[model samples]
Target: MTAPNRPNAPRWLPLGAAPTTQRRVFCFPHAGASAAVYAPWRGIAGDRLAICPVQPPGRAERFREKAFTSVDALVDELVADIGDQFTGDYAFFGHSMGALVAFEVTRKLRAIGAQPPKHLFVSGRAAPQLPDTRKQLRALPTPQLIAELKVLGGMPDAVINEPELLELFVPLFRADLTVNEAYAHRAEDPLPIPLTAFGGHGDPRADDDELKAWGELTADRFALHTYPGGHFYLEKKAGELIDIFAAELAG
Candidate 1:
């Protein structure tokens, strides 16, 4: 079952009614996405891990809220708002732009001496230190932006064809891209936590070497797993990926 709509806690969407569970897995979505993308994970994760999907502003229930344009500001607010959720065992799973946000939040939490995640699962994003090679899509015209999304292959064809949908989607999409593109990684000491990096073998945005570079950010165990697909590989490989997550968390 889906979690109740949390009007107060704007940052989290708890997957079930349980107050807590063995572990909490905070899942962050990619650019132009919302917590709904992770709703399926509620069943996939089972009871061992509570899937808490984050809902950033300017989308879904928070549609009226202004989206964050600065990554640093975003992380600062998230760390502060999350409060006691980090008290027990937890992990972070982020895809694409979300991975960078998760990484920054992890760093901010550690800096404040809060409890750190047992593991960090970063997917579809290169290590933060690597310079972004993708063309800046945030500044593209409406037609070009729509074309780029079509090439990315995650949005429904209906959404692409519907002009009314594009009216709302385009701005949010550009806002999210702007937030990600504006990010500037600040050097810091390597984290002591283990990190598991996931990448698509054919994804140009996150090459093998770039994914492997995640190792340098972790002082403990580091692993990289490549799946067979392009940028949105998780859509097709969710079951396999969730199995790996379950095994790792269980271990």
Candidate 2:
């Protein structure tokens, strides 16, 4: 399949992926997360697939740059900045806020006549079109935000305990929450690629029916998998998830 003409992968994109893999999965982290979140997948994914973690600005190596507060702007930049990587056989895996970002990015890619992902794996989030019924926490003050994060099991105690790190992390994550909480879902035809939704049984964000709703946005195929933990369940189930990735992307 022909993709849009763009420069080769930029320096900001890491090259630590499996060299011999036949397919690539660009993994997007949840809100306030960095590319480091997916680092362990490199080893678990083995050689069948390459794990490419997406690093948004204001996180990790790109911490100096400002992060986008609008989903449209982020999607637009992602398509233009990293659209080159989608040229080959590739798919997208995103969790929580990342799931929403990845879904929108795929739509943008298609709108530009770029080669679409082979499959889309969404985790820890509801389908984009669904109305969020949860209380708004994006505008919470520092202490309250920390409380919400702890309640949602978003950050580790180690990171939360470090005052210096919390100072840096809070605003970046709040910006991402702004992107998430303010997202306006425009109606569009379902994408013609297989979609798989995963969630923790105890996840407060998206439950079974909400997770199942991801099928509505995909005309090709749909699947759902429920794990035993909360929003951050994948942290403990990475090895199992990697096995599933191998099975699904064998083509």
Candidate 3:
């Protein structure tokens, strides 16, 4: 693996001529979100790194396709889609349901003996191994499920108010929640990579201590950062998060 900070040219070269690490960060979105959610990040990231959002089926351009409900199956399909493309230094950032998907995808990459992420950044989720005690709300009636999502935040009031919008949003959310609620965690040795976990101060799902549980999954380095917001804190903390990514990927 290429160290992010390892100079690509001789040290004697002029500083401007020295090549810096330019990594590709694959991002996964929260439940019921499309790859479009990360579109704004390109401008934020600038040229320091590339932001590639993983778009699973059943959303956006893939709206006609069925979404994957099984976490393991989703990981398998994503890895297959990735193939051998991770030959270059890369990283991962995921939030909420996406956080879990990103972590599982990283593990699947390791299983295939493929290139691993230089660093793993996960947000809005607790450690995967933790038993999910949250009530099963995926199968709830549409009104109840949307209500629950409202309590969790992230869904705009406009989306909730429009019956036409709910027709499109509801099924995708059910599939995503099913993915989260049906997941079964299997024990594996900790990964040999740094992991930085992010959380919202007011997020009932993943508090400071819950976020810290991610440390147990990495033997290299572990960090936990909390922001002041609810479950959708990243919507407000994007700048700070990208800034950290820039600094971390530099080395």
Instruction: Write one digit per residue (lDDT tens) for candidate 2, span 122-219.
Output: 99998889898898878888899899899889697888999999999988989999989999999999999999898998889899989999999999
Model 3 Cα lDDT, one tens digit per residue, 1-251 = 33233232211111112121457777888899888788888789888877777777778777888998999998887666554445566788999899999899889889889888889999998788998887788999988998899999988889999999999989999999889889999999999989999999889778787899999999999988999998988898888999888788888
Query: Which pairs clash (backbone N, Cα, C closer than 3 Å) in model 3?
Result: none
> What's the candidate order when arranged by decreasing TM-score?
2, 1, 3
| Candidate 2 colliding pairs | none
Q: Model 3: runs farther than 4 Å from truth?
A: 1-21
Best by TM-score: 2
Better of 2 and 3 by TM-score: 2
Q: Considering summed lDDT, which 10 consecutive residues are worst modelled in model 1? A: 1-10
Worst ten in a row by lDDT for model 3: 9-18
TM of each candidate vs. truth: 0.93, 0.93, 0.90
Looking at model 3, residue 186 earns an lDDT score of 93
Give all candidates' CA lDDT scores: 0.82, 0.84, 0.82
Reference-based TM-score, model 1: 0.93
Query: Local error of candidate 3 at 116, Å?
Result: 0.5
Q: Using lDDT as the measure, name the better of candidate 1 and candidate 2.
A: 2
